[model samples]
Target: MASGSKWTYSQNKRFEDVLAEYAEDTPDRWHNVARAVGGGMTAEEAKWRYELLVKDVELIESGRVPFPKYGTPPGEAAAAKAAARTGRRG
Candidate 1:
């Protein structure tokens, strides 16, 4: 469950979905994947499931893309501050 040091509910969910889809054994299925985590999946695994990460990152990034609201601006500084106070880097 603790996929990595930065894994969150959404990240874990994305990882699980990627695993399930990849397990289907359909190389052409083209699943989403992201290297958003430090060690949830190996580099090969992330590359194999690149689509899953794309989707996950898309979803996460979309919240602030074009214009980040909620005073979160989608920056490392804000993220770091948030993480320090709430343990959430994203």
Candidate 2:
């Protein structure tokens, strides 16, 4: 895969699994993560991807991005209305 290519769902899942195996203080953590993630990803790419994931989590936690409602069908206005009435952010 090219350096600029986006990660596939499987690749992202593998990355997350591998990341959990390697702690932040682990030596050569990025290299290990890249090797585990495979798909021709380099250490820098794995590190960058992790950083992006962290930023995404931060945004959601800060309410800058709405939390996704899983299993909600498209055009489900009723769910949104119910959530609004219950004072829930989604």
Candidate 3:
């Protein structure tokens, strides 16, 4: 389990610390991930599972998603595409 408060950035740090051990053990589903981490853990907690981290890493490496605001950056991609359609710029 992660150290400190659930919402802290340090939680991510702790998650990273465990990434290697769990790297090859990513679960396909959130429930599986939670179970792997520990049964009775919530799906929300599964967000920190090594699988999600690997997925995020793949997103970065593939350039399928950008790096700001966790990649998509709230409405940014849609807004940019919309601007392009309207013949405008941000």
Model 3 Cα lDDT, one tens digit per residue, 1-90: 542235445445544555444544566454554554453565576655545667888998899988746455446889999999999999
Q: Tell me how far the alpha carbon of residue 52 in candidate 1 is from the true structure, in angstroms, after superposition.
A: 18
**Estimated TM-score for each candidate:** 0.28, 0.69, 0.39
User: Global lDDT of each model?
Assistant: 0.53, 0.82, 0.60
The 10 consecutive residues of candidate 3 with the worst lDDT sum are 2-11
Q: What is the clash count for each candidate, in the order shown?
A: 10, 0, 0
The list of candidate 1 runs beyond 4 A from truth reads 1-4, 28-90
> Which candidate's lDDT is highest?
2
Top candidate on TM-score is 2
Better of 1 and 3 by lDDT: 3
| Model 3, runs deviating above 4 Å | 1-6, 21-48, 69-90
lDDT of 1 at 88: 59
Tens digits of lDDT, candidate 2, 12-38 = 667889999999999999999988878
Distance from true location, Cα of 21 in model 2, Å: 0.4
The reply for model 2, stretches above 4 Å from the true place, is: 69-90
Please give, for residues 7-58, the per-residue lDDT of candidate 1 as tens digits.
Answer: 5555655666755655546553332333333344555556544555567668
